[model samples]
Target: MTLEISRLLELTTWRVFDVADDGRVLAGCDESGSVQLVELAEGGCTELTALAGAVVGRYLPGERAVVVQHDSDGDERGQLSLLRLDDRRSRPAPLSELEPLVRDSEHVHRLLDVLPGRIVYATNRRNGVDFDVVIRSVTTGEEHVVHDGGGMVAEVAISPDSRFAAITVPATKPLSDQVLVADTMPETGADQLRELTDRDLAARHLHPGWQPGGLVVTTDAGRDRTGVARLDPRTGGHHWLVTSDEHDLSGRLSPNGRTLLVLTAVDGAHRAALHEAATGEHVVDIALPSGGWCGYPLPEPVWSPDSRFAALSFSSPSTPGDVLLVDTATGTCTPLTSSAAQLAEETLVEPTVHRVPARDGEQIPCFRYAPAAPDGSAVLLIHGGPESQSVRSFHPLVQAMVSRGHTVLVPNVRGSTGYGKRWYSADDARNRLESVQDLADLHRWLPSVGLDPSRAALWGGSYGGYMVLAGLAFQPELWAAGVDVVGISSLVTFLENTAPYRRAHREREYGSLIADADFLREASPLNRASAIAAPLFVLHGANDPRVPLTEAEQIVEAVRANGVAYEFHVYPDEGHGLAKRANRLDAYPKALAFLSRHLG
Candidate 1:
């Protein structure tokens, strides 16, 4: 059944951000992309605040107050705000007014943990480039820097006893980074920080969280595949807690530090497990609902204070995301919200996973969704983040196109995560265009699945958007139409104009502009705009900071100058992607209409 754009928009999407200590309330964003506090008993949600940008909130331990992270114009220089649930006031006050400890600068601050009378966080406020672990008092509003060093600080985990903070420093090589445990004493300095793991310098060690005896982290340190391990903060010794043949394995310790919730990526799908934290013995293998894998940032299963139930957000090919409460002991799952119940009931296409061979003999993983009725047309939906993978997540655009009888293929091309460190970085720098070649291979492989090559369209956002532009330019005769959503048109321009704090990270992944300028220009779609033979649709947000609006404007100008059939759109309030429901409702239908007009 073809669902209307309005019905797709009406689907209330929810994410389980944080569960209250008593497990009575959950905090997340509602359908409108606004911060909301949800009551577990009544399944009712209260809209807390409506900001112009995206916001992620976490509840302070044992308190009704929440710490929210938001940025201005999607620059990603996030700031933490405090909102009191007990306040009878009309709206929660700003962070600058409520918490004097936080600065209103272009710095990123993330709440780590809330202790008895203190709140621990990590911010780049110290240098505006590298993050430092900071602990601030809840009542006095005084803050202290616990760890400030050279490398970028990723995740910070505070011990239950409030004695030490475990911080993960990501390196170019996923495994070679270091996890340091710093004493949270009043006058702690850089000298007080002790490296918990001997740097492998080649393997990936990430997602550090505190367990009862030591630190639990995801690492591929002596193993071919990434797995969960326990590290001794005192001796710098560690042992693998869970290992699998799968490429990615990550886990989180429950609130009571007794149960460990483990998630592994087998091929591209996720398999969850519950393990005993002390002995690392498997308790029960979780049966995830048939849909997509849990959404990214991979919702760390929020455990009830009693450790009986865990809350997380799950989405699939057919349904939008919703919060689910899983019985940790029984392995039974219950839906906490009915956000996607109706959509799940709809006759949506269930995607079949396929491993298509690339030009270079490498196997490229893809999910293909074919409409029941034949339309002799297809669309290639690429994922962004040369580092991100396209999982079985609920995709409204894909569903809409499929419902209209367009076969959709979502490929996890080279450089996508969840495929091990080596595979994840395969297309870095000069090797990037090989991913586009993979797309070309996808075009050749389409007919094997009963798709028409002549009527094919390419659509993507962010990095995927770059792929669409590249496909149209390089393989000019391959595609009938193309859509770029907030995608980068020029690699050189994107690196030069992206936010200062993000420039270094992007350079590491995409190649240094100073060193690889010529290569970047050659690889950019803007440079090859004259080669584009297909009709193109470009959509972007004016306030985007990552792939700045200029990325879209320059390409649109080039495409129009070339006299190619093209359409352009910009959302004034949106930062990166269309996070707001109203904008999506307007954009998705227009995109589908454009595809229909051209591809059909």
Candidate 2:
């Protein structure tokens, strides 16, 4: 049963956004060849919004209307819209029923929390660089600015009484953040903002939610690994609620504040459990798929109003993304949505986790997917976000390559999360190339793991794409070919041309342009393009806000000057990555064909 690459690419994926009291679910699915919003009920899945790119949403208190955030093309400037729901009618409603809520095309807006009469969000409309957290009334459209202390606002939460708000903002260093609290009502003289955590510590705080006693957040401030803690708003002190030595811990509280859904990151996989919120007592460990992704994208484990049940999105190599319904009392997880499109789960390959030793005695964790019938070649797939980890998730490109008989190795180099704070900050600032050194070590160790060193190619997107180009340019003879999607060629040009809101945040990890210009130029692949002698394929979105299209154009021009074999493609409607299925179906197959010809 050999399936075509198109068939493998056709596999649909979904993400759960919110769950209603009556067991209805709000989700994002790619069944329409593009990511769109849909409502999951007993009758059937009904499309809610037909907007472009990807859409994320939540049920406004009553479940009669939903507040959705969507961006045009791939520009990343999100706009908020309200979709009026009438579940009584039965048939799917038209896309024209949406009402614009907060749409400012010049700036970015992100929805943080939704309540009965208002919604909390972070927007950079104030000055276009600093994000301000605002609570706006759903009926009157009145806005109340809570915290505007000048930094990228990550997460925000409203108190149970709707009087106080808590937010997480960047601290003095990279990968470190602090939580702040402020009154949501401007009429109250107590609206003055105050820090909720120690300002001198270098810890990263996230997932701020109000409990009866204090603010519940996950931080690694005074510890090596992240753990759940309760921060006292008045005293600026904290105490541990959930702590683990072997893994990073994060949790979300139920609406009633009685139960906490905690997720633990074990290497690249996840483990979930229910705990008593008051005493932090473990209730029951929920059984989950062996290798599946359950953490990330902010919203997961959306609980019902009564806190009896929760919905979480799960995905892995063999399973396409789907929402799972979890019962807290019995610890039962039932599938709520299916996007397999009639494909057999057994046909897909499952990866085996391994720890590859680096040259400096450091062990790098990776997932290897081996095809039943080998084509004598391999592809090293690198993940983006030197800050992000490559976990067990459904990747269309990885599956497509396996179906074509190519073994794939996905590694999490130093500076990737899910490990620990120490591991993630290893390659920061002056130590940038140390992460690239791990790539060289992996290339050398490939033969020991039943892979052909001479027939291997490099594949990645964004920062992963930068790794591909760096490997080819820095260690020219190691790879057969390289496929770079929206990769940075020159750190100097990247910092200069990237979106203003993202520049400072990215510079903290990749070194500053003003202080480390010479080092940045020397590390750029575009500086040594002549060193690349292998065939290459470069793909980028013309509207990419993070890494501009100039990145692709300059690299292509440099490689062309050296007479290197290469293919360059630019998607006018795409940004950082391919968000549309039609574009992915077209781009990935060509890239695979290029790898096939070069590897042969």
Candidate 3:
């Protein structure tokens, strides 16, 4: 049953970045890790552009061009390029050529919308610190700032008539707590910036976009669960578009602005539905055949220009990801690409969703993958972004371990999103240690599903990596081995050393180092590394900007001083995660070996 590493690496990974306005052409990353333009009718794929490292942004209005973001060595501070499909013989040009909106040092650039004669975008090029909304003419190359503010412009949307721009200004508070609807007049330079929504220090209002009458956003303003709501920019009136008690709802307006494509996440699973934009009447519920994660870049559901079909990216435990077309009328789905066809003969395990209760009576939703044969050993995989969820995605490492007879349990811990806002922010600041307790509760519940808690390993990246370190430091007896990947070890140092642009945002979630100094030290696993009883493996990218290399080095220093068995690795060319296939191939096997040596 030993599978070749090459076979696993060869699996075609696909990610749908954008569907053309006409929905005839789909743009996405292909097997070679390059963006390709696929024509739906003929099923012909043409290589659009290839770079050392690039992520396809979105297609322009008429599908004549696309925005590609490229970075070197995963630094994240990369340049944006416009890949013109019309110029088939020419290569992508740097976005600066069109207008000097993004400089070499100013790496954050986002395309907001494409108007009649201009393209609207958001960039930190104004001060290289805070984002500013800019409108650049397509023909003249003249640009004007629509909204310049002291805070980071998180989201931006240009109205269809190109008169107003709705921007989410997160500077009002630590988190994005306000929305500014402004008139984009070239003569005034956005002098009239009006507040569209009332500020709530506790609630997060995000994804501001324009509809026919007003602005629409995802907010938990008056409820625990985040839902889609329409806000009147003029009168500050609010109307609920979609609301749910058991699930969180967020969506996007169709190209014609007649329908709303609602994305719902219930217990870590995603479902899509089309609704009447004005009446909130559900039209058709699109069935997702792939039981996996969806909507990575917020509202990824793209409607066709005619609003007859919607295209989206989907991935499951067995499938990597593919662009799917869903008919609005009948809700029939058709796959536009087959990225996981290479694994057709391989046996993949389907994850079963289970709710395990924590000591405090909170239900932790976990995805369990059981092997065909019993090994009496298991691994608990934690997800990053304590705000993110662990959905049923195609995880090669999980499959590899399961293939060798190991059960894998991935939990959507309390702090994870896709749940209500209250549950998502449950682990803020001092309350984060409670999340570690949730991990212990998960270990205690393992035996109920025929798993041996004593023989279990803990594995995670980013925040999950922090959880791995926490599990070893706090609940030492629960895990046999642990793997930490690009995780925060010292909260205080991490807050001080992380990228400046991200400091305030991280402070909003993890608690500020200046204010919560004592709590940060108390929760940091590095300070309590002496309590670790299990063998540890630490993996990180040297270029990581979020957690930084020091986070891993400091913990390795502690483990070495404690005389604990441990392995440490740092990929020189990677950033947050092992994004490059070669790095993954090199790093994952070492992780599998470490788990095997300790847990088996």
Best-matching candidate per TM-score: 2
Clashing pairs in 3: none
Candidate lDDT values, in order: 0.77, 0.84, 0.76
Writing each residue's lDDT as its tens digit, candidate 3 over 1-600 gives 655555676586655655654556445554664333333444455656556654556565654766555666777775555655653544433333332333465466677666555667777765666767888765586888878866566677777777888877664333337878878775666547887776554666776767777787788777888888888878777799899988888878775767887888866668888888887889888777758446653236666656777788787778777778877778787787786777867878888889898898889989999998868899999998877788777778888888877899989888888877777778877788988899988999988999888899999999899999989988887889999999999889999999877777788778888889999999999889898879999999998988899999999999888888999999998899887787778888888888888987
RMSD of each predicted structure: 2.8, 1.8, 2.8
User: Which run of 10 residues does model 2 get worst, by summed lDDT?
Assistant: 87-96
Give TM-scores for every candidate, taking all chains together and pairing residue i with residue i.
Answer: 0.92, 0.96, 0.93
Give one digit per residue, the lDDT tens place, for model 1 in 1-600.
786766776677777777754555465655554444444544355666566666776777767777767777556667777766753555534444344446565667777766666778887766666777888887788888878875576677787777778887766653256787788784644457777766545666776767767788887777667888888877866788887875578787886778888887865567788998888899998777775355464465677656777887877766577777788879887777765567556777778888998887889988889888969899999988877788887777888888898999988888888887777768888988989988889999988888889999999999999999999988898999999999999999999898766777678777888999999999998899999989999999887878899999999999899899999999887778886777888888999999999987
Evaluate model 3: give its TM-score. 0.93
User: Across residues 1-600, which tens digit of lDDT does each residue of candidate 2 receive?
Assistant: 455677767777778898888778888888778778888887778888776677789999875889988888899998888888876655533345677778999999999889887788999999999898888888899898888888788888888888888888877677777788887676766647888776556788987777888888888867888988888778867788899988998888887877888889987778889988888889999887657554653246688767888888887666778888788878898777765545654377778888999988899998888888877688989888888888777776787788777889989998889988989989888887888888888888888877789999999999999999999999998989999999999999999999988888888778899999999998999998989999999999998999999999999999999899999988898999998888988898899889989988
Task: State which candidate has the highest lDDT.
Answer: 2
Report clash pairs, candidate 2.
none
Model 3 alpha-carbon drift over 4 Å, by segment: 2-6, 33-43, 86-103, 171-177, 186-191, 290-293, 297-299, 305-308
